[model samples]
Target: MQVAQATEVRKNWSSFFDQVVHDKPQAVRRNRDTALFLSKTHMEEILSQYRFTLEYEIEEDGYYSGGLKEIDICWSEPSLEELKQTIAKDLVEYAKTYMDNFALYHNAPNRRDHFPYVMHVLMKDNIQEVVELIDADWERT
Candidate 1:
């Protein structure tokens, strides 16, 4: 494994991808304390393990958001199953975290009496996958 920063990764993305295809994973680091990378096989395993279906909403700015609704419980990929399971578990955990934060902000003593509208908006949309990608730190971790 090798470590690189976000800028370095951007500059050498082609070489990095080539290495990934060759089965060598490169770790991306930021602030000298983070790490991120994944082997090609590991990525395939994650895709197979989850077997999730997604629905998305597109905004006027051409951006999009989506989430997993129904998962294929019987999907079986021996090598990558564990990775997929971990991702799914993390999704639920993160959703709960959002809920917790909403609670905190909603109940803040200095805040207005209005209910937490942001939490409602988040809950109304399915964004588990987005959360995973955001939290995963795609480049430098």
Candidate 2:
């Protein structure tokens, strides 16, 4: 994790590409501004630790209901399979909405911590990958 001056990196930006790929993410600074430049895959790997749980319940009417409470997103469907698909679809929509207004979502008191989870959702190449994150836990009474 090397820290380099922002100007130097900018001046020799081409050389930094290899370093960013081979080495741990580097820190760059310009005056009071400092930030890490990391690969998208690396960022995803790092954020992978922040996972959301999938919860659901069988309603009296036989509808399956619930979703990731951490992000306040949920869905209801007639079957468990449809529920999973709905959950995945809803998650992707939520992620897109969150990213569309990143500053707003990131600044929100309740949603501030949702960044990692939202990123996790967006990282998935498809809905199946996102659906796999959910454990098959269910509440039935």
Candidate 3:
């Protein structure tokens, strides 16, 4: 990866684009790595090398219990925004079903190591609360 200053990149983006095209990866630094620019082919290859796992717990109405679901995402070189959007879409689908039993099983607060997982049981009648909770967690991640 080639390191380029943010100011330099901003001042001459066409040159930076050419550098990224030739070098494959260029780290744009502004005190820290603000962004990494890469050729489309190179970016896809990098993304294809990793397997991302997303795990979450939800209530099951039939079992009156909680279950952990693990989702494995294999990205074929999508942009960061695209990856986040895909994950958010998948999470919403799973969240809607699991959250139906939220009131049935998790009607009280439980001690969790994670601060955000420590939820207070409030609105028992609405599924919107669960949706909001899931959305909030998604955003945080």
Candidate 4:
């Protein structure tokens, strides 16, 4: 509710930075556009509650197709390792694509809430980490 206009924010950039980085998120308004500035740490912590799971189905001939719970991306592979690796690569690619067309994607109603999940993938070091993050720890018999 504490929204600062664009001009006031620009004039007091340092104070805003200090408040956002050290204290909490700050809201800013420019024209009709409004945005919130929050730290990456806070974002990660907030998104931590959301689990990145995968849903899979086995084809008649033994092939498997799976999709990420957080994003709509899917992959098909002959084996579990290959499937995980493929999905990881796909997630990395999708995250980059999301950032590349941020304005368009963010404005989309279906994808607006996906920013947290996309950032989770984007913050990863590599595809391997992504694989591990979404890796199933199922204890199957």
Report the number of the highest-TM-score candidate: 2
Model 4 local distance difference test score: 0.81
lDDT ranking, best first:
2, 4, 1, 3
RMSD of 1: 17.6
Give a tens-digit lDDT track for model 1, residues 42-123.
5555444333443444434533333334421222223233334444555455445546776674576643232332222233
Residue pairs clashing in model 1 are none
Q: Candidate 1 at 21: error in angstroms?
A: 2.7
Give the clash count for model 3.
0
Per-candidate TM-scores read 0.29, 0.87, 0.35, 0.69
Cα error, candidate 4, residue 139 (Å): 11
* Clash counts for the predictions, in order: 0, 0, 0, 0
Write one digit per residue (lDDT tens) for candidate 4, span 16-94.
8988888998899999999999987777777666557877777767777788777787877997778889988888888
For candidate 3, lDDT tens digit of each residue in 1-141?
A: 557789988899998898789866888889854787778667545434222233322223321111122333222213333444455444454434335666643553441221122121122124343233332112122
Model 1 regions lying over 4 Å from their true place: 44-141
Better of 3 and 4 by TM-score: 4
In terms of lDDT, the best-performing candidate is 2
Candidate closer to the true structure by TM-score (higher is better), 1 or 2: 2
lDDT of 2 by residue, 1-141 (tens): 567999999999988977787776889999998898887779888977876676889998988888875777788899888887887788889889999999999999998988888888888899898887666568655
Off by over 4 Å in 3: 50-141
Worst 10 residues of 2 by lDDT: 132-141
Give the per-residue Cα lDDT of candidate 4 at 86. 90
Candidate 3 has an lDDT of 0.44
